[model samples]
Target: MLGFIDSADSHLMSTRSCGACSLHSSHRHALEEIRKVPISKRQILCLIALAYGNFCVAACVSLQAPFFPAECDNKGVSSQVYGLIFGIYELVILTASPIFGKMFAYVSPNFFLESGLFLAGITTVLFGILDRIADSLQFTVLAFSLRIFEGAGAAAFLTSCYTIMPLEFPDHISFLFALLETFFGLGLIVGPTVGGALFEVGGYITPFAVLGTCMILGSLVSIILLPKSGGVTQSKSPSVFAFLCDIGTLLDVLTIAGCLNLIGFNAATLEHHLRQFNLSPTKIGSIFIITGSVYALTNPLWGKLGEYKFDARWMSILGTAINIVGLLFMGPADFLPIEPQLWLVIVSLIIVGIGMAAKQVSAYIACLNDTINRRGYPNETSTYALVSATNFSSCSAGAFLGPSVGGYLLGTIGYRASTQVILGFEILTLILLVLYKLCGS
Candidate 1:
């Protein structure tokens, strides 16, 4: 069992990206708590459960572009009504994450995770049914109600993944997050491909139903694997920051958090731009394929790089730059003569793909190490949760803004102008980094 506990500590759900910085006193206390508990199968179950739930979330997300409009039209809804729907969903996630984070320290993570998966599947199933009912433009009420449950379930599953992975394997925390993040990326890539195929064969109903089924299966796997996680210590909130004894951990985590948000902004805007180009479902799917291939192929390399050789900050920065360039190219891809612009867009996406892979892995690795060094969290699991959620909070926020602005820019000036806006955000992010360094030093 300990051998399943990889010489690498992090699991399919962890995300630390650093090493050997020194554990904080609080981390020492957490590790001590873990040592006192004997390992059991329950801990593994917890991890499997969360991973399955996250996979479900990704499945639904991957199919959105294909299904959402059709689902809405099945009810006589107009295209004019789409923006608020997406916005409301984003709003729910953005508002719900921190609350869920705070809740993780108090509630049973397993219970929270299970309840979330249960609701996510249930509400999604309902979303399918609701689409069939389509009466009037109570769109806000109809759309947001489902989004509330989706957001709640999503936040819960995410928080639990981080919380459980570390406790499941305490000493080898870094590699643990590496595996977790890698699988997470892999799932995100595949979910869409599957969803796209379902869209062609079965339309909107298929993705929703398949997603629900996936959640159900995930629920069962979780029940079996979670018992292995019985070794977990109760979630604790230590005062490493209040005492300021964990600067490296804190800074590294925050820096990565910012970069993660930027990735979301870039990706979200890029997607909307792709749509503006009137790309076919097959073409869009192909782009996802390209992005996923790049991500999946490179993830192992990034992990290997981080093991002993990679400079995480450099990785994060370079990732951000590549994403910016990709986004900028997308603008021209939209309008320019169609031949070179298309190739340019594809190539630019490749760059974005590489950056996203490198950025997330390195940042996560760095965060894991900081948590371990500063707090001595044998798993650095909880800190990973907080940091990841913080990053995603930025992610959800940027995604929300990205679409609205991207849409407006596309409508008013076009994809080229919108791409410029995305570039501006990247520059601003770089400026933010400089400011952070000045303050930190």
Candidate 2:
């Protein structure tokens, strides 16, 4: 009787194994068929909605940077308080993404996308008119409140889009994702200039009002156009914790965090550092433009490389090396005899931007693929959501840390020394990538 039971259990286990293998094979064949076909009109519409959503959310996030600080000063808010106001948005995003990601088993991605857009749009418009509040305390409270809500909305919208893209464009995941990221970068590039101009014309309220209204309109359109998909099999789906358990996936997440940390570090400190040049605000904005433009333009190239089956780990290492060179020249390092020159700064910013695009895009693809291929997660929407949530959470954490740490280091240790700390981070990332490669091989 015991021998008969063992034989039955063995047969059951083999049957399950065969079923899993067949499912994976079917998924692979479906993807190959998708690759062979032309993109449908529905796919085009979905892409448009996703792209515009990315642009709107990014623009709204950045547009306030140009004028908000001065407004806070005028309202008697201290630099520390106002800076937290900026950092708090990312904090909220970091907190909210995982919840939405976990909800993927129950909620549709389209619902999150549309609702997030609506919520974000409304909060943005409400933020515009905070100038009417007379008391400093009241203004500050409302400012923080509005930003918190805005952050939540943006997190939802971004997480859903990341989830949706892999499902909608499985064949062109890397390239299409890169293209969407390019739009995001463009929005970042355009936001400050547009905000500055609009502020000049109509003060604090105008930029937010206009951008927010447009975003709301965009959200409404997405409701009609975005593709609809059902949730995944909850029984088979792994938790976000499960996904992160894979060492390679965890390192990829860290790589993403490190990349964004450099970006946020620059955003907080670079303008202040450029003050030494006695350049006007307009000129400073132009210098800032250099990095965004380069990053945006070069992303698709990296994405193409990803589609070509480039080894993401090696790409990350190469990109990190380039970023180190950029940072070395960015401060003209203390060891170097040369003074920091504008021309050299320009060149360094460009190099940093290119490296950033490479590192960021490759890390994203690596995380997604590693989760599916090596980690044995299903190639389904739930896995996508979990990966997207993890990546976005890392991004928010990095963004939040970057400015806070950058500002503290800039104040305490001064600019060049602060950059050395950041350089150390990149070097550490490089070392890890090389080790990951060596170990995997």
Candidate 3:
């Protein structure tokens, strides 16, 4: 009895000696961390700036989408030039992503991010002024050139912001990432809506000018408050080239998300599908509302899950499964052997949105975890740069490819058949993911 009491006293004296207590303490610490929110004014300012920057980047990407063709027509340029202008923007972003990522070795991410914002602002101003040019060839040339520059700026901005995120909010990295994505998604939708309104109010120049001013203002705020350096020191950073050469480390799931985005966007347009139903324009628009709302609502939830060390692979698998089910149900809602209800279309899209959120959030967290845990880097700017670059490039490529390929398939093979093509691609992605999981385990 004396010996047992002595042992209990010793255990009480040294908490670490009690394995169960140690575990409970560790778990308590983790829970405390998860519950803790950012409290610093600097953190709040930085997050606001980052979120706004994401919004601006997405907005800029889509702003010209609606008005470019009309503007080209006004300048007497061929409609083909319109596509070139948009294509050039995305192409430049794709190529510059890695280049800017490499630059982080020599320069601070803040410099790249701020400079990119400035560049985007200046290019937007140039776009507004280019409308004054009366000559078609000159107008086309200058506009395309400006857009290319804007793309470079966008690449720098995106890379820097994402790289800085984990650094700034190390404790809540996944949550922050989700928030950034949410703002970006909103920006994509808002840009065109606001741009159209501005066009109606004051034509092409007005939207550009208004948005440019806002960007410049945001840049100034960032310059004042943004960190002068990236999250990790350059001295501790790995060589970008070395990282890229290690192709095994690259997140293949990102490429899948990119492909999914392509299919998802094409599905969102739903012009041909809706035509089959003979729905009114209002009804067609409501279909988009359903999908978009679900996507936006669930983004933050996925982000929180990622932050909590949720198994991204499992999340992705679940997401992909849901996506496949959605795609299968989208086929011939009216003409199928057993006529599918219109509500199935809505149900499938909601499931697809949830799946997309899971895949996107989980894939990002997986890559981030791989970099931090597997590679064991102290400062992860280069790794994050590559991650951000891969994401931007893949999504951009998918956006460009989805419409082009999906359109061709739809035109040639019809809606039901084109869906099969998309389904096949998704299935391929799922198979690869499963293999990846097996290898990882």
Candidate 3 residue pairs that clash: none
Model 1 residue 267 CA deviation (Å) reads 6.7
Instruction: Please name the candidate that would achieve the greatest lDDT relative to the true structure.
Output: 2
Choose 2 or 3, whichever is better by TM-score: 2
Question: How well does each candidate superpose onto the true structure, as a TM-score?
Answer: 0.72, 0.77, 0.66
lDDT of 3 at 23: 14
Query: Which RMSD values do the candidates have, in order?
Result: 6.7, 9.3, 10.6
Winner on TM-score between 1 and 3 is 1
lDDT of each: 0.56, 0.73, 0.62
> For model 3, what is the alpha-carbon lDDT of residue 394?
58
User: Candidate 1 — worst ten consecutive residues by lDDT sum?
Assistant: 1-10
> What are the runs in model 3 whose C-alpha is more than 4 Å off?
1-44, 65-87, 125-143, 163-175, 200-205, 227-251, 259-292, 300-314, 325-351, 365-393, 396-400, 403-420, 434-441
In the range 16-57, model 2's lDDT, one tens digit per residue, is 224444221222243444467778999999999998988888
lDDT of 3 by residue, 217-254 (tens): 77888898886664334444466556545433454434
